[model samples]
Target: MNAENEDFVRRRQLQVQRELEDATRDEVVVEPETGRLPVCIESALPSKCIVSFDAHESEVNALCWSPSGRLLASGGGDRKVKLWTVLRGQHQCMGQYLGSNRAINSVTFDDEENLVLAADNDMASRVWGVSDFRLKRS
Candidate 1:
C-alpha cells in the first residue's frame, strides 16, 4: 500500500480501539440529595403547602400570582377564570371572569395588576378588570 494509505489505516485502527475502550468503560452513577433542589433556587421556593382550596370546578390549566402576592388568578377547563384573595394562609374566591366558550389555557395579570388576562382554546384572549371582574376586552 502507498504511504498515505498505510497512515490512514493506522489512524483508523487507533480510532476504533479508542471507541471500543470508551464503549466498555464503566459509567459512574451520582445520586441526588433526597427532597432537595439546587441551592440557588431552593430558598425562593415554598417548602410546603400553606393552604389548599377548590379553585375551579374542573381541572385548573393555568395560574398566576398577582404582583402584590395577595391575589391569585386561575384558569380552568370549565371555561372560567377565577381570582382568589390570600390572607393568613387562607384563600377566598374573590370572583370569576367569564366569556370564553372554550377551556382556558393561560391566565396572567397585567403589570399594573389592574387587569387580568386569559387565553383560551377558543382562539381568543380576554381581559377583565381586577376591581369589578367585568370583561374589558376579548
Candidate 2:
C-alpha cells in the first residue's frame, strides 16, 4: 500500500525471521574445535550415552544442577568445586569455589538456586552465595 506501511511490514517480517533463527540455534556456539554437541544434548532423552569428557583433574565425586539446568556444579578430588555452564552438549567451567581443606565430597544447589552447599573430607561444610560465590554464615 503506502511506502511507510510497506517499510513497516518489511521490518516486521525480518524481525520474525531473526527470532526463529535464534530459537532454533544451538545454545552453545563456541570455537568449533573447542566444543562439540553431543547426541544426548541434541535429543532431549537418548537411551544411550554418546559423549563423555573429563571435567576435573581428579575423580569427580559430586554434582548438582541448577534449577534451570543451565548451570552444573561439580566437586572433585582436586579439593575444589567447579561451576560449569552447560549448553548444547558443551560444558564450560565458568568459575571455581576453593578453600576446602580436603577434597569435596558433596555439592548441591539450594531450592532457589541462589546458593550452593558443599562438604569436604575435612569435616567442614560451607555455603556459597551463587551470585558472588562468597562464603555465607548464618
Candidate 3:
C-alpha cells in the first residue's frame, strides 16, 4: 500500500484500540439489591433505559446480553449484527459482524462467549468469532 494509505490505516487502528481501552477501563456499577444490574422502583426490576444509542440503520430485531452483561449483541433488519460494550450504563459500538444476506431475526452469545450466533430471514443461521468477527459457520 502507499505510504499515505498505510498511515490512514494505522491511525484508524490506533483509534479503535483507544476506544476499546476506554470501554474496558469503565466498570459496570451494579446495585447490591438488583444483583448485577440497577433496578427501577417503578418496575420493581431493571427495566429502565439508563442510556441509549443509534444501534443500527434499520429496526433492531434481536438482542442478547453477554453472560457478564458487559457486552450486547444486536441483530437488525439491516442485515448486520453489531456488538456493544456497556459500562456503568454507557454504551459504545465495538464492532460489526457481517455475512447475513437477509435481516437477522434472532441473536445470542455462545455459552463460552466465544461466538455470536444469529438466525436470519433467509432461513439460515450464522456463527461468528466474538473477538475477530470472522464467520465461523453458516
Residue 102 displacement (Å), model 2: 0.5
lDDT values for all models: 0.87, 0.82, 0.89
**Model 2 residue 105 lDDT score:** 95
Candidates ranked by TM-score: 1, 3, 2
Clashes of each: 0, 0, 0
User: Residues 19-133, candidate 3, lDDT per residue (tens digit)?
Assistant: 8677656655767885675343322223478988889999999999998787899999999999999898778888999999999999999888999999999999999999999
lDDT of 1 at 54: 83
Candidate 3 lDDT at 120 equals: 99
TM-score on alpha carbons, each prediction: 0.67, 0.62, 0.66
What digit string (tens of lDDT, one per residue) describes model 1 on residues 26-121? 454444756554433312223599888888889899999999888999999999999999899888898999989999999999889999999999
Q: lDDT: which candidate is best?
A: 3
Q: After superposition, how far is residue 102 of candidate 1 from its true place, in Å?
A: 0.8
How would you encode candidate 2's per-residue C-alpha lDDT over 7-87 as one tens digit per residue?
A: 998999999877767655647444568567544344222457654678789999998898888789999999888898877
